[model samples]
Target: KKEKVDFIVLLTQSEPELNIEILEKYPEINAVLAEEKSEKYNFVTYVGEKPIVSPQGNMGSIVKIDIFKNKDGKIKQSLEFLPVDSSVPSDKEMLKLEEFYKEKLDRDLGTVIAKNNVKLDSGFGENHHARYEESNIGNLIADAYKNHFNTEIAFMNGGGIRANIESGDFRLRDAISILPFSNKVGAFKYSGKTIVEALEHGVSSVDKKAGRFLQVAGMEYSYNPKDEVGSRVSNVTVNNKPIELETIYTVALPLYIKNGGDGFQMLKNTVGTVEIDSEKNIDSDIFIDYVKKIKVLNPKLEGRIVVK
Candidate 1:
């Protein structure tokens, strides 16, 4: 008698390309349980007779799968995505832990550091205008970085500004929500030509909701979207004077960009020269301290990033 196996399921959290490669290498695989998500697929995606499913159950959601064997010895499965929202019952122990963490977080993040006079926006998905246009939130972050680090210019990525802040009391949590990353303030010494290249890189994808869009302080620039990418940026100025490509400028930005995150290989090349007094201030804390010092949040779009 031979041993019987109806299904071979694979568990992986790799990229979709690797997952597909694995399936191709092992055609015997019938299903893949993955943490990787793709908006293109809903519920389940099939590769021939094989099915790929993602159990993003970390969000308190539940996934139930039922398997059955027919008389002919073929295995069939059905999947259900169960919501764990208000209808679901909470575990008492988990609830206690949640309460403990929530209490700690509220106490730590509840301090009102500043008062906002207007709503500052980052963006709203594809409809987000901050990607190509100047935004107050972007201005706020950039200004904070530039002023705190005492740099000639600061270039904060518009996409890094995640949420909007409304008028009234601004708390530490508000700052964290806007800049929810572990990245610290980083400064670089770069030639004026590299600054131009950075600005060009920032505006190169003006047609898409690209994260490379730079939110700036201490400079104003204009670009023609219809023009070619490398030459789109024009009329670059720092301190109201035209940018001199030969001059060295001290620039403040997130460490992520300094490390070539978001395809900024140009800035990445200029990483070794640290021109700032300190590089240990986490971005969120920097934003908070900036707000505390300012005491009022009144960021405005001052024609910093212009599109012609």
Candidate 2:
């Protein structure tokens, strides 16, 4: 007594008929089968197999990233597809992958900038404290120059502000953002030696990339890029009059520069210690008061750092 057996041969272009031995020789195919098995036994079987038809090997992947800003932040979602190679990717393929990564980094950086929620033309800290520090710090320097000293111009460094303020109620975190490093503020009296030496030190710092970009509350000067370093500054004026080096004028800057931190050695021994506040965090109070007074983007760049 014998029974009959039946076999079905499925044939179609939809699926490739692969010889088990030949397919095993292909490392890419073996990897694909391994991936399929691992997913099935994983803790969470969330996504199912959705193969991408490619010349090399089909692959599937999912990436999730979160982006936020201000008090309320938003999230963004995306999906990507890549072809798996048996070995290392070719040069052209690597270039394409690098470009994709660069775009991702740029997107993250933009997200960080937007979340700060401030209107300053250039700064690092959060919106509330950073803006307040901008207006207050500039005004503080100006007031010190006009009232404490007989100078009509005062300036600080923009890089002085380091961190950002947290929302609701601000604290040490906010102030740290405004003046993150241990740089102390100082007032110096110079006969226009302030701007000249500052520019010289600035040019010198071009090599080290550590110079504090100058932030001025009053006074103005134009530099000729075509001219030499020391002679680049021209038409320097305070209150509509030319600056006289022989006539001593008071200036405000961070102690980092006065102590020769950013390569300003000339100012190390020339500056005179004057009455001023120590390294303090007052941006939160200043910002809160500013918001209560007005709701607007008042800060604007007045050609402070121009490259033309």
Candidate 3:
């Protein structure tokens, strides 16, 4: 009670008022309870900043958790995340990530090829070429899955393409360095409700710097990043038609998004999901190889992702 009272006093703006019940019971807490209630509440409010909810502002940054049991037996976790912002240089973080990737690349040529940059001959122009090429790559991947494995839509992350290939030449290692994080493409079967929740989460997380980038092979959705959570997504279509919320939809997303990365915690809680591991699976690698062989790959907005 002494520590609690001290903490309360330290946090509040006004003096806390005390009820005499504790003094009546034990007679020892009267002095500790002399503070006014208003002060205590004000102090408590200032102890921690309010949680950020809007996409335009800084939502809570990524945090790592380390857990331990307190003396009172309540389990508490300390935030162990590094502080970072847009001002931080990418190279500072690049080397740390590259070292781990180099070790992995040593073992797998497929992974290495997918990460590298291969500048194809300039029969195709840049804008039309890249967008069409990426879409074609997406289509080929989707087609490959459809023909062999039972798959519906294939989705890729636009950010996965680290750099543009020049007409002359480029290194695969350069591409890998650009998109360093080891995220695999993932496919999942989900209920319409689950899909809605996932889209809502994804759209609401887009910041101005980090564009609401998502590549879809099937289905289209438009959402406003400025809108409140759960209200962002609108004009969703599947198979060239409006999406029916009651029907199940098979959608493809990066493995990170499926596992609750990028503020999509709803993905973890949603029920009845079948996630295809992109790393172990041959379908995704074959798709990438097919793209490389074609010498063209690019993705453009097909009215699937948007802002108000």
lDDT of each: 0.80, 0.42, 0.45
Q: Assess the local accuracy of residue 39 in candidate 1 as a C-alpha lDDT between 0 and 100.
A: 22
Task: Give the top-scoring candidate (lDDT).
Answer: 1
Estimate, for each residue in 1-308, the C-alpha lDDT of model 1 and write its tens digit: 14557777898755455677888888878778876242222346667767777754334455677888999987788777776578987899999999999999999999888899998787643346777889988888998888888888999987677777779999889998888876777777888898999889888876865678888999999999899989999999999999998888899898877777767888876734555565456898888888999998888879998888
Model 2 over residues 1-308: C-alpha lDDT tens digits? 13421211122112122323334444232112111211112111111221211121113332222222334432222233332444645689888998998788555433222122342233342232222223434443233333333345555554454443333333333433444454445567666765667754554332222324445556655554455657655666666677777677666556566677545676665534455543342333333333333333234445433332
The segments of candidate 1 whose C-alpha lies over 4 angstroms from its true place after superposition are 1-84, 87-89
Clashes of each: 0, 3, 17
lDDT of 3 by residue, 69-95 (tens): 678855443433333466545785787
TM-score of each: 0.75, 0.44, 0.47
The reply for model 3, stretches above 4 Å from the true place, is: 1-150, 156-171, 208-213, 269-279, 282-287, 298-300
Better of 1 and 3 by lDDT: 1
- Spell out the clash pairs found in candidate 2: 69-115, 126-164, 163-177
- Compute the lDDT of residue 235 as modeled in candidate 2: 61
Cα lDDT for residue 24, candidate 1: 84
lDDT of 2 at 300: 45
Model 3 TM-score on a 0 to 1 scale = 0.47
